[model samples]
Target: MATRCDAIVIGSGQAGPFLAARLAAAGRHTVLIEREHLGGTCVNDGCIPTKTMVASARAAHVVRRAAEHGVTVGGPVGVDLRAVKARKDRVVAQSVDNLTQWLTNLPNLRLIRGHARFVGPREVKVGGETLAAPQVFINVGGRALHPDWPGIGEVRVLDNTSMMTLETLPEHLVVVGASYIGLEFAQMFRRFGAQVTVLEAAERAVAREDPEVSRELQSILEREGVAFHFGVRGAKVARSADGGVHLALNAAGVAREIDASHLLAAIGRRPNTHDLGLERAGIATDARGFITVDDQLRTSVEGVWALGDCNGRGAFTHTAYNDHEIMADNLLAGAQRRVSDRIPAYALFTDPPLGRIGMSEAEVRAMQKPALVGVLPMSRVGRARERGETQGFMKVLVDARSERLLGAALLGIEADEVVQTLLLAMQADLPVSLWRRSVPIHPTVSELLPTLMAQLKPLEEIPR
Candidate 1:
């Protein structure tokens, strides 16, 4: 016999819990099934723990530069890896606990602590119980991708999740990917007194960014004592005699070897839908195993939906949360919110973070769209100059005809928060002139936006 509910939410990721709460509040009997921690990746491994450590790293970085701020500190600054891990653990625990409490108190929601698998079109198996629900939402999320490299099985390798658990700092950390995750960890560990090197198979770090942005970021990280090997091929890994890991790669047909105390495989992430028995439920997935869904997050099977990284639409936590909102609005509020309506945006949490929204200049150019471009260096920003952190620049793209914002990227201090202003402008369909004329608070990183917009030039003026 199977226990039945009105709705079943799988994996307690960003989307699952919020959707479950909405269903329960709508007087529906909802079951929220979680195989691991209640708050999933964001609270447990991805955002909370990593950002907490990044904060510690930032503190160390600032303290080391205290002299620049006219604040004389003690002789030398140091990092205690154990203490850093402890603080991250506490932050994760608090977030998980708060989410667990909220879920437990939901009146009509049942929180199941076990793995779930689809047993039928409308039924799932978890533990010794069979649960059936007409409406099933899969938010199983994703996990770190493991590459099949030589000696990978023989040597100890760390992924993003396991790296956070390391109690001792590595003397030399070799990162396998130069994406956002790899770069963040590279900088964080470097600040923690590690000699870090990053290897990327792509031609450049962050291949998706504009070439100039990629070069600027690489320069910044390189200046911070991080070595990078790009356009690498035929990479192999092995254990050295001293028990350290050795990575050999071919760069432009030349063989090179790098020995490091630890190896972090920050290649990418994969959807966690392998063992879900999607075939039993008639659910379709793409070649990468990400569940296929329409703009409204609807799966092939009626009354079933997939959200979060599992669906392959957007992998960020914010996008996952927005998926829940879209589902709730369409299903419960008689609204037509859609996944396609969202403007892509994300932030890299490096010291001088990179905040990005909409298309990149390369992307716009690829579409052959007429664009107006503007750029301002952090050196011109009063606040960045005062803070002595002027290292990057801000760029904005506008439609040449409408003067409407097409995209924006801020790669300087407080960029993560400052990018939101342009996001809102894009969302509201505001013209570039409006942003140019708007009076922002003086002496702030964001206030430079107006001045930046004042420098808008034809896209043809952009240096190749």
Candidate 2:
């Protein structure tokens, strides 16, 4: 016999549990299904675990730089990989436990521990039981993309998830991609006393950012002993006789080889829609397998919605959480919220993190939009200099006609948090003059925002 419910939430990801809670609180019977761990990638493998490890890496880096801060350590700083893993495990476990407890306590909500597959437009099969509901929400999330490269299947390689489980640090870590994920791990392992080399197929690391920002970021990482090979092509990997990994590639028409103790492939991510049986539910997906959804996160099929990375909209946890809010508002509160109304925002958790909101300078130019731009180095920020961490710069862009803030890229100490203020300002549609006139607290990295805005010049005035 099949169980009937008012709603079905597939995959206990950032959007699933919240949506299920809202439905259950309204006295609707809801069933939330999960085949693996709760909290999806964010708690199990992605954000929570990686950020916890990044924090440990930052501590190690700070200890090594204590002398520059006038604090001397008697002995050489060393990283115990086991201890770091233990701490990360504890944090992840606690988060999963909290979510599980909350879901269990919710009335009219059944948390099913099994894989779910669509059997009809409004029904799914989980283990031996069948569930049917008028409303079904898919939040299955995504996983690391594994590219089809020669010898990849024969040789051992680590993805973002598997790399975090390592108990021993590699002597030489070769990262195959230069995206945010690759760079974060590259720097983290480098600070843990590993020789890290990052290779990117593009002309620069983070191709989406302004060329100058990419160059500056490369310089900062290089100063920390991280090697970068840009414009690489025809890359292949194989096992060497010394039990290490051998990577061969061409850069600038010169062929080279890299022999490393470990290789991490941080190419990208793919949506988890392969086994969902979306066809059974008549849900449309893109070429990349991401579910095609409307601005309100509704699929082509009625009563079926897709959220999170699987939806091909936004991939960040915050975006996924907001998806839940949008759906809940429309379904429960009679409020009309949409996925299109969000400003793009995310952070890279490197030592000097990169905080970005809205479009990048390159993106703005690609749209052929006339804009005014401002640039400020972290060296000019009193807090960065005081902390002996002056390594990056801040940049902002404004529409030439409206003088309204369009985007911001902050790459420095606490840049992640500092960029949020600009994000909020952009969201509020504040004018450039407002940012220029606002007085920020002294000796802070964010205080330089007003000074940066005050120096805004025509885009042409700024050097490429």
**Cα lDDT computed for each candidate against the true fold:** 0.92, 0.91
Task: Estimate candidate 1's alpha-carbon lDDT, on a 0 to 1 scale.
Answer: 0.92
Q: What are the per-residue Cα lDDT tens digits for candidate 2 across 169-279?
A: 999999988889999999999998999999888889988888877888888889999999988988887888988888888986789998999888898899999998899
In candidate 1, clashing pairs total: 0
User: Which whole-number lDDT from 0 to 100 does residue 109 have in model 1?
Assistant: 98
Q: Largest lDDT belongs to which candidate?
A: 1
Name model 1 segments beyond 4 Å from true. none
Give me the runs in candidate 2 sitting further than 4 Å from their true place: none
Question: How many clashes show up per model?
Answer: 0, 0
Best by TM-score: 1
The alpha-carbon root-mean-square deviation between model 2 and the true structure, to one decimal in Å, is: 1.2
